[model samples]
Target: MYKKLAIMALCCLCFTDCSQASRSVSCQVITITDGDSLTCLLKNKKPLHVRLADIDAPEKNQPFGNKAKQFLAKLVYQKSVQLRILGNDPYQRTLAVVYNAQHENININMVKSGMAWAYTRYNRDPMYLNAQKQAMKARLGLWQDAHPIPPEQWRRKKRK
Candidate 1:
C-alpha cells in the first residue's frame, strides 16, 4: 500500500504545471493552426499551443502552404501524441519534438515528406539535414517548385 501511494503521488506531481520543464506529456491534437503550429489538450492541463521544433513550413498564403497544413492534419488531427517539451517559443508556444502513437518523429517526417524545411538556423541534426536533402533530391511536395520561397521570406515580403 505504501508503494502504491508513492506511485500515485509521483503521477500527480508529473501532471502539475511546475513539472512542465523538460517533461513529456500525452495530448490530443485539437487543432492544427498551420503546418508547424498546433493546439493540443494536455492531460489535466489547459490547451497547449505547440510549435514543431527544428522545422518551418510554408505560411498559409505561400506556395504549398495549404498542402502543408493538410499534410500535418492528416498525420495528427485528433490523434494522441507525445510531446517532448524543450522550451517555449517567443509566442509562448511550447517548442517540442512531437512523436505519434507509433513513435515516429513528426518533425523529421514533415521535412522528409517535403512539407516543411529543416529550419537550419536553429537545427543542425543530421537526421533533419538528411531528410531535407532527400526530399529535395526526390523533388517531393514543395520541392517540385523550382524556386519555392521560404515561409520566413514570404512573411517578410508580405510585410513590405
Candidate 2:
C-alpha cells in the first residue's frame, strides 16, 4: 500500500509540472472540417484536430452550415494559427482558442460574424455573449433567419 501511494504521488507531481511543456502550438491549417473544427499540421507533430472553444457553428445540412464553414475557411484556411490548448472535449477533439498570425481571435470572431453561436455550456465570456447579442440585433449571417435553430438542438432532433 505504501509503495502504491508513493507511485501515485510521483505520477501526480510529474503531470502537474508541465510548465516545461508547451500548451500552445503554432501550425498551418491543413483542412477545415467544419465551421468549428479544423485540422492543422504542427511542426513535428501529427495533424491535430481542433474544435473552436466557446462557439458552436452550424453543421452541414443545417441552415447556413456551408456558409459557416466557408467563413471559417476564408479566415484561417492555408493560414498559420496559434492554438492555445484548453484540453479536449468528450468527443476527443482538442478544444482551443485559435488566433491567426495577426492575433485575431478567430473563435470570438465567429460569434461576432453570426456564423456561430456562443457556446454557453462551456463558456461564459462576456465578449462572446456581447458579440452574439450584437449579431442577433443586427441580423447578421445565420441570424438573418427568423428562428435560427441551435446546432445542438438541431443535432438532437436529427438523432430522434
Candidate 3:
C-alpha cells in the first residue's frame, strides 16, 4: 500500500501542471460540464469543479464531443467518487485523478474507451499509454473516426 501511494504521488506530480498542492476529497458528482470536467458537491455542499487528469476529451463542439460527454455522464453522474486532487488549473477547476466507489480510475476508462486521448503533455504513466494504444488498435469509440481530431488541436483550429 505504501508503494502504491508513492507511485501514485509521483504520477500526480508528473501529470499535473497546477498552482496548488495535492490532496484527496470524496464527493458526489453533481454535473458533467464536458467529457473532461465535472462539478462535484463536497460533503459540506460546496461545489468543486474538476478536470480529469491524464486525458483530454473532445471539445463540446468537435466531432464525438457530445458522445464523449454522454459516456462520462453515464459512468459518473450522480455517483460518489473520490478524487486525488493534484492542483488547480488556470480555469480554477481542480485537476484530479477520479476513482469510482469500486476504485476504478475514471480517467483511464475514458482513454481505454477512446472517448479521450491521453494528455501526453503531462501524462507519463504506462497504463494510460498502453490503454490509448489498445484503444487505437481496436478502433474503439472515437478511434472509429477515420481521422479523429484531438481536442487540443481542434480547439486550436477553432481559435484561428
Candidate 4:
C-alpha cells in the first residue's frame, strides 16, 4: 500500500511540473529597460518583465552602463520581437531570449556588435562567446576603453 502511494505522489509531481512547463508564452518588446531587463507586451494583454538569460550587465551607476542600455534600446525598444520564455526568475520576471522582428536572435547580435559581453559563467553558447571574443579583438565598444571594468567585478566592488 505504501509503495502504491509513493508512485501516485511521484506521478502527481511529474504532472504538475509538465503543466508549469507548458505555460511558456511569447511576447513582443515594448521597451528595453536596461541590458538585462525589458518590457514585453504579451498576447495575454499583460506587459511582462523580461530578464535576459545567462547574462548580467553593469549597474546603471557603473561605467559603460548607460551605453549598454542604449545599445539594447536601439536593438529592441519599441520594436516587435519574439520572446521565448525560459522560466520565471527569482524576482518573478520572465527569463527569455528576445528575437528581432526579422526573427534574428537579439542576444547574439548584441554580442556580435560588441554592445554586450558573453556571460561565460552561465551561458554555454559557443557562438555568443566567439562573437564577443571577436569584438574584443577588434577593440569595439566597451573593449575600446583601455581600462574597462567588467560588470561582475563592478558589482563585487560595490558590495564592499
Tens digit of per-residue lDDT, candidate 4, span 56-158 = 6666787667888898998888777777765666576776777886888887777777667787766788888788889889988778888777788888998
- Which ranking of candidates, highest lDDT first? 3, 2, 1, 4
Error of 1 at 130 (Å): 0.7
Can you give the TM-score per candidate against the true fold?
A: 0.86, 0.86, 0.87, 0.79
Per-candidate count of clashing residue pairs (backbone under 3 Å): 0, 0, 0, 0
Q: Compose the digit string of candidate 3's lDDT tens values, residues 40-139.
A: 9999999999999889999988888999999999999999999999876667688999999999999999999999999997778999999999999999
Cα-based lDDT at residue 157, candidate 4: 93
What lDDT score is found at residue 128 in candidate 3?
Answer: 93
The TM-score obtained by model 1 is 0.86
Q: Could you tell which candidate, 2 or 3, scores higher by lDDT?
A: 3
Q: Write the per-residue lDDT of candidate 1 for residues 81-146, one digit (tens) a residue.
A: 999987676676788899999999998999999999999877789999999999999999899999
Number of the top-ranking candidate, with lDDT as the measure: 3
lDDT of 2: 0.89
Note each model's CA RMSD in angstroms. Answer: 8.0, 5.5, 5.0, 5.4
Give the winner by TM-score: 2 or 4.
Answer: 2
Residue 141, model 1: Cα distance from true site in angstroms: 0.7
Give the runs in model 4 whose Cα sits over 4 Å from its true position.
1-25
The candidate, 1 or 3, that scores higher on TM-score is: 3
The CA-based lDDT of model 4 is what?
0.74
